[model samples]
Target: MMAGLEERLDKMELAIRKQTFRENSGRANEVNFWVFDYDPKKELEVRERIEYMKKKNEKGTEGFQLIVFDLYDMIMEYLEEKDFVNSYGRFEKRRGFDYIIRAVSTSMKMNEDDSILIRKIVEQTPENAVVFLTGVGKCYPLLRSHKILNNLHQSVLKASVVLFFPGTYTEQELILFNEIKDDNYYRAFKLVK
Candidate 1:
């Protein structure tokens, strides 16, 4: 069991690195990973997140994007603080955020349409940006849409590295994840890995 667990963890890390490469290709920017534990509802935390992001952006690094899956409320609050207003009265203006946050639920449920939307959003990102996702766990799907999966598989070809966080999981779950990140599946999703 221990050996199996180690193998699973190793595999997850590889997949993450690969995904990161695909996401950052041809952008000519350095990608940095930061994990923060904060509640978006808290004012102080929101401020801190904004400060951190601004500091990174100031560096003007190309292709730098942060991926956050959890603590979405904090991100929302930060956006609100910056006056990017999510909703308004009569006059509604949609604001763009610097980081990408994917809850495990959204990531797992993402279909082709969602993937396209996400791709479009990413295309609009400025320099030295970050995308984040938090609260990753097994027993839950990482990506939900088979259709989106199909689309992403069609494009990704050569992902240099993959990274995965450590967690506990059952044997069957590990196997399923392994299959999802498999190299062959990259072509099917139009994603490079």
Candidate 2:
């Protein structure tokens, strides 16, 4: 009964379109954060639907904005903009994978209030825009989904934030790709059942 991914996505789409999902609606006390978790193997299909929904909603025919920020792309762009792209690869090769992990973590300011990822998202968010955070699986060993959620808790993201997790959010912790179990608990609710 309405168990297909497409059907679930359609339900989520309808939910976001509701006026109650925006500011001045109900749930003002909550963070308006949500997780749309799915099977890791179906990342491609989910992404396709997300892109399709994004194009459809971003047109503002619904009187609200749907903004998607692929975290992996953000990290790449952040590194590039800061001129770290050149040394990032060489540093990994010379210093090693473990060392590169720390470097990237520090560079991204993981879980910090002033993190580059958080700042970029906060800056680009317009009034009545629903933020969709994606690419969690791709940012592995670099960006943690829980850390991003935790950091967003401290940031000024007033709009609804939905994380398109390529994993399972067990309502308590995030299991990245459904293999790596993350103990970092976040307060975001599931966008749809």
Candidate 3:
């Protein structure tokens, strides 16, 4: 576990619990998006802590609702359900990396209207709930972090979106796995230090 993991989690919880956070007060017109950046090596620990947080704060009642969006799982299930797995691999080898990336991005509906993942995020989230977005590392080369943020900032405006980013968020750009530059997404604030 990382040092002060408990404190960071507590800060996240308290931020999500506060009315101002949900309402986006004093944000200077920024959406209610936050980045909970952590070391990529501690992914399992972060996931465990997230589960603990969810257990402590149940969704839909009593406390604020918490909806987690695991991008890797979402894409896997989607690929399986659509029977695109076989063809997807074939496309990668035949069409080249860039072409395959575009195909997968188009199929995933990234930053587009009627995107299944975006729709799920909007539909599943109730007002004032917390949306935890994980699996950035796993969804690499397909679903970029900035693209999702761009998509959500316009649609899912009510709920507080907390992205469990497995990298560094410098309030300027996202560095996935500390090597890949995920482009600039300055809309979201850093959830904890």
Candidate 4:
């Protein structure tokens, strides 16, 4: 049992290293990452998602890291990514970003635990990188009401967010949360389909 666990751990480390090496290989000192769909079946789903990205991006001839994390693992992964970028001479100007598309599926008001962790990560990232959050239903109200989020610059939002409100949103809601959708820094709601 211990040996099996050890092998799995080694595999995980290798996967992360492979991603890091690929993304930084030819991007002119830039870091490109994709935070894809998350699922509870982490090991299998994540690996499959990475493989899918690998195939999809094959024509680009450039390396990029594609990450997927379960809600339980999101916080730690964010911190790990934080440290990883900092170590590579990008302590503040980190180039990586994350996506949270499970917000609606996981909680009616957004997961406070995840929200706090994401807030910390965004607070720590540099001003240039973008973070995106997306999911079905309106997470805008909750996000806007959070006192900790108001002060966070759009440039440093824990992640560039694309709240999946699903239905047409009111102008008032847009006005209240438009900064969250500022496209000057990064693209929001990049249509995958």
Per-prediction backbone clash count: 53, 0, 0, 8
Q: Point out the worst 10-residue segment of candidate 3 by lDDT.
A: 56-65
> What 10-residue stretch in candidate 2 is worst by lDDT?
22-31
Q: Candidate 2 at residue 16, lDDT? A: 87
lDDT of 4 at 135: 28
Cα lDDT of model 3 by residue, 84-175, tens digit: 98987888788887987787788877768658788888888777677899998898878888888888876745787888888888999999
lDDT by residue for model 2 over 1-193, one digit each (tens)? 3267777788998988888887633354866888999888889999998899888885779889899999999999888888998897898889888887788888888757889889999999998888899999999978888888989888878898889988777789888888999987788887777
In Å, residue 136's CA in model 4 sits off its true spot by 5.1
lDDT of each: 0.33, 0.85, 0.81, 0.33
TM-score of each: 0.28, 0.93, 0.89, 0.25
- Best lDDT goes to which candidate? 2
Model 2: runs farther than 4 Å from truth? 24-28
| Candidate 4, RMSD to the unseen true structure | 16.7
Model 2 CA lDDT for position 11: 92
Provide the clash count, candidate 2: 0
Ranked by TM-score, top first = 2, 3, 1, 4
Q: How far is candidate 2 from the true structure (C-alpha RMSD, Å)?
A: 1.8
